[model samples]
Target chain A: MKKVLLSTLLVSLLAACAGQDVKDQPQAAVEDRAAAQTQAGADAKPTGQQSVTANPLKDPSNILSKRSVYYDLDKSDVKAEYKPMVEAHSKYLTSHKDAKVAVQGNTDERGSHEYNIALGNRRADSVKNMMNVYGVPNSQIETVSFGEEKPRATCHDESCWKENRRSDIVYQGE
Target chain B: MIFRKLLVGAAWLLLAPLAHAALTIEIVGSGANQIPISVVPFAGENALPQGITAVIAADLQRSGLFKIVDPAGVRPEPHELAEVNYPDWRTRGADALAVGSALPRSDGKLEVRFRLLDAVKQAQLDAYSYVIDRAQTRATAHKIADLIYEKLTGDVGVFSTRIAYIVKSRSHYELQVADADGYGAQTVLASKEPIISPSWSPNGAKLAYVSFERKKPIIYVQSLVSSQRQVLAQFKGNNSAPAWSPDGKQLAIVLTKDGSSQIYLINADGSGVKRLSYSSGIDTEPSFSPDGAAIIFTSDRGGSPQIYRMSVSGSGAQRLTFEGNYNVSPRFSPDGKSFTFIQRVSGSSFHVALQDLASGQMQVLTDTRMDEAPSFAPNGKMLLYATEIGGRGVLAAVSSDGRVKQRLSTQAGDVREPEWGPLLKN
Candidate 1:
């Protein structure tokens, strides 16, 4: 029972730092896994393993799986660390022109409802603009701002506010 | 961002009241001077449908301006001019005394008579009577309290006004209307989708709000009398933030149909649609001045959301607020001298602020971390808004001068988006 409590506490502590580390740790782990898979010879693959091969969109070991891009308070500017994730999604969209994506803008619950909607729109549009610069057409991207209607964290302090101010990339049929 | 996908299916729960409970107003603070008033038990009150004197006492007590003396069984209940006991109330430290009675009429109605007396002078101040049906006893009690409050304070009382707000419990969202004291709550509309921005019409007959029932936000104007609603604006994309014009002839709404969210003017019956604002960024939350000459709204054209004013025709657009990096939801006072909105300084939270339009001076009214959607009382005595308390949404009110404060909360669920309706015309 004591070990269970300690593990739970440690997991929550790590989850508390997940927002900052989300930009770095997940992509790094994905890269290491991809390199290990390449080091193993392709001819040694077992039978019926083709069905288990991960699709990049649904794969937990790909950068495309990381969707959220965090921002500063009341800011719509995407950070430099999130550029690789956004670039990966842009590349996927450019290769798969038939695919469509929706970018949702969000903000912390700080100001008026309408103002947050505008802020959310700006955040979503910022992601769309970056995708466009990386060769994704406007026709393939739809942007909407949920404002502060949905919150990632229902807290009133800075730690929760930082988690709420973000733009998310959602693919078709997601 | 990943939370958005998870909230899609889990957000809308089965639409039902978590509990059929009435909102109770909690007086968090009060003014320094409290008027001492004694309300002796009304004679023959038990025979009536509702307690007459108890309603009157509660109406006065909730205003945060009057203090009700218990009387403690020391004073006898009196109903007429012949029953006189002025010295009893005077010695009990009551500045004023009220005595009343409820008598049944032959037509199955009730007549309530009340007399206000000056305890020290031992003279009657005023006397009146109201003939009402059994169902109108609560309203009559509020009217009598309004009369007494005006007679003492020389200011129009808001006890007779009504309030409309949105209450959310889990996945169920309800738009509720209640008395100014947070009693007699009636759910006007309920749906599985989110409902927001309840704005009252000029005469308090209808409310224009945005609902997301159809998978997208659409504005609807609902009548309180019939429980019937009309789709005012269901444009191509994102119709929201409906504000009624002063004359009740038009509505200033925000629509993203024109590629970006901009203010538009349409007839109250959803006709003669015309675009009112032409901004590159978002322009929304359009509120009219009391006289209806100009409209005030929040716009991000200046890089950050700020309050901007423009004529009814959408020309002469000028920014009104410049104190902070963030300001939105500007609502003009009834007299059109000042306006209130949410202002964010160099901090992590937003506070409700009052700004004088003539002098461009501002005063922060609340100390809470997050406050929004301020609606002024019809009499211009107080302003109601939504704020967070222990992670739950609740409604709060403060006097226009920022002296007295009160919290109106429910037993369960999150109560928010409070709009104080205008005093209905007789």
Candidate 2:
């Protein structure tokens, strides 16, 4: 009876070892094959495979609909939804020291041209300042004021005016 | 000899009808249709210069209300009103006709005499002669057009007014002044760098533009007559966006010496700098209302770019625009009933829009790709703004009703940032 119990324990141990080897096989293969597959769509293929293996990071449809921060009228505080965009931009600027960007400020055609230009400049400067605080060096950012010179819409209503007053970010140099 | 005798007899017979018809037509206002006018080319005596009649004709056409009969439609008859055959002009649809001749004056100037005759009524509407220097013959023609426009439309004519704008060339930029129709432009200031934001004084005697001289942006007020410039503002951070007050006694500008952009009122002589805005975010672009009681400006304290109205003393700050997400640049119309501004929509395109001050309703003025920098005409009947066409900036004017639109293209370079000054008598 003691000899029979020892043989049963050995058989159970071999079964447990075989199950552990199966689990370890895929991970070890991934590690070993990852280097050789660098030129074979490695990043894209792995990300796709990872999506199937785990939770997806993002929904593809939401990417096109995403917008930068939109502020209240006459305000510049970042909205909660735009925090990610700002953070991403900040992160990129922080990582790339040689990258330079420009922020162009604009206004709707309601006030005097002179006034609008100054207001636009201030808006651009506001964006530049925010970027600076986000670890972007002053030299890596530039600001210009288009004022009421460039409107994105032609409507004479409040709806169009709300869209005209904005600051746009443009990557100048990489 | 027989034709001369018959013409003499006809003139005598037409005198009575001319006198009676003048009283009837001049006293009543029944004609609302096109005046059916013809401006005859002035007879050039002594071979003085080029064609001046075409200039007058073009000026009237630019108004978009005048219907000038083709030169070939009406026959060139005698210069005298009595010599014109009323039936001949009536058949040609020429309700009114202008006949003029220029002669050398004894004072070495030019005497241009013109006569306007009513073809249908067989009467003389007006007859005047101007004594001007030979070089000012074109101006004389414009004056004639002005007179005729006033006689027909019963509104003041803007043919003789000028427009000031910034022109960007390949390597240089200039502040230019030109006729209202964008002809005969002369550069008032040319710099190797950028010259921007041209503003005209109330009296139209001077222009204020921001020049990037001395490696920094400075506001320079230059007299158009004397070509003299005075650096109005050159502060530590930036001294730009100079807006002349209505009374011409002071200028409203944005200065950044106090850590944030704020509106400041300074005397035209560069004295009495009074801060008007005190806010955490930027308060810039201050444009005074027509009545000078209030100012419309752009501020970002509320989180985004939007228009705000405040008293000149910096009180009663209230938000004006709420719709959309972006609105900036607020220019008050001369009548103070409406304002014009730029609005940006999706896809990063911009257009000019007008807002009724009382109703707060807005209307888009342009449908082009990028339309901006809208300013009111002196009469508030139209708006002038900058539009990019074929990658070149051109100045465009749109009627207040948005029906009549005109593109004012400069001879060279990109013309932008137009500022229409008030009518100057001189």
Candidate 3:
């Protein structure tokens, strides 16, 4: 009985994908949303930048592969340690016009839901602004705040919270 | 097809067996003055699926204002005024006596007649008769509880009202509307993505909430009856924190298209967007006053997030909280005399706190840590909020006086973002 119930829930979860039934506005066909495959495509060949794109971003040795910037509690400023990584990704995106990045911000559950949303927005915007300073176009970047909803770590203490309060630069189609 | 199936499944709660994940409520701490009341089982209620007296007694007990005088194996249950049971109830220390009967007629309607009497004085306090559909047996019992609540304490009861909250189980989220007692929950919207910040329209016909299904935060207003929804705000950047005006004609939403998270006002139909706050920092979580003349929101304009109030015309901005550096999510009471918000105590833990507007006095209502989304009941007597209990999320309630705490737990995953719906209109 439990297995049947689980299977029914799984089928319903798969069937009720967003926008197929719920969305009212006609979703624009502006950009491709195959973010899951963007990494594989971008890693095959060198995207125009010099050393950053010379190797696959999936390569453990490349700094361009480092896409996350962690923040302090209740803070949104991008830290100095992640500047080189941001600049490397910025160089790669600026060199390749079609290489879009969606900077997603997250937070610990310490703050209110909506407040974390606002704070996460600031965190993502802070990274996007840094990339723009490195000569990336504003049009090439999209920022979304998960706002403690999508946490990388689940523990209630600071050890997990330190990992949750951060932003990730996700390449389009990846 | 899943949405259709869900619609059918959600509709089953009206008359079918209770859902598997039904909520169980636990109460602690009684009100300052507890009135002992005896609720005799309605004479013909045994024939119905549920006894009306049980629901009424549970409602009154959950409020922490009344103590139940359990009548077990008592013969000749009082069904009318001439039952002459005041002496029996008075000896049992019951100050008030409630007697009623439910009789189903041939027309398929249940005639519910009830009376509340002063047991000590042996006088009739109030009597009511409601003929409703059979499916409304539980609802009518709640109405009777409300009637009895008003008659005895002079304060309105919130048993008959509904509350909307988000229940997150695994990767899926369900927006559910349930009775104020945490029973009879019906899923309004189910999704795999996160849905938060549900704000009910003034009349309780519609709900405005932020959905992240679009991969970005967007505001949508959905009708409770039709299950149809419209994108209220799909602007560039973060579009979230949708709050309805008291008149339901306009909505206060937070948008980032203007460079930062700032509050903006738009019509109910998603037209006429107007920015109301200008802060280089963050400004979100807009809550309207009961009169809809002003809005109180959380802003970091003073270098730390604090509650601030501004008029609807975008004038007369003033800071309201000076105690905590992290006070956020402010909601005004029904009477607008005070507001409830989450205040971080000593910069460590969060607790639901009430603030008085006239004297600027603040009192923490909940002892639990990590309390957020403090929504006042329609009567301004209790507050519903989200808190973490034993590492699992649950919904809790605390009376405005800081007494009468309750824990409303679901058998399944966490329930968060509980908003008490307005009193329903006939």
lDDT digits (tens) for residues B1-426 of candidate 1: 111121211112212222212212122334557778888777778877668789899888877778898876663466665676877776777877888787788987776777777676666766766667787778777777886676666667777789999898876789999988888999998765568899999988899998766544689999998978889999865788999999999999988776678999999999988999998988988889999999999988998889999999999999989988889899999998889998886675778889998999989988877788998988677899998888898999887778768887754788888899987664
The best candidate in terms of lDDT? 3
lDDT of 2 by residue, B335-357 (tens): 88888877777545778888888
Model 3 segments more than 4 A misplaced: A1-55, B1-30, B346-348
Real contacts recovered, all predictions: 0.40, 0.22, 0.60
Candidate 3 global TM-score: 0.87
- The digit string of per-residue lDDT tens for model 3 on A37-119 reads 24333442445544654554554444555566778888888766666667768877877888898898888988699999999
Candidate 3 per-residue C-alpha lDDT over B1-426 given as tens digits, one digit per residue, 9 for 90 to 100: 111121211122121222222111122334876888899988789999887999999999998898899876555767888875677887788888888789987987888887777777777766667777788888888878887776666677788888999999987898999999999999988877789999999889999999876677889899998888888999998999999999899999999998889999999999999999987999999999999999999999999999999998778889999997899999989998888889998655999999999999999999999898999998898899999989888999998998889997665798999999988654
DockQ category of candidate 1: incorrect
Over all chains combined, what TM-score does candidate 1 have?
A: 0.82
Model 1: CA > 4 A from native? A1-55, A94-97, A134-137, B1-33, B120-123
CA error at residue B42 for candidate 1, angstroms: 1.4
Each prediction's RMSD over C-alphas, in Å, is 12.2, 19.1, 9.8
- By TM-score, is 1 or 2 better? 1
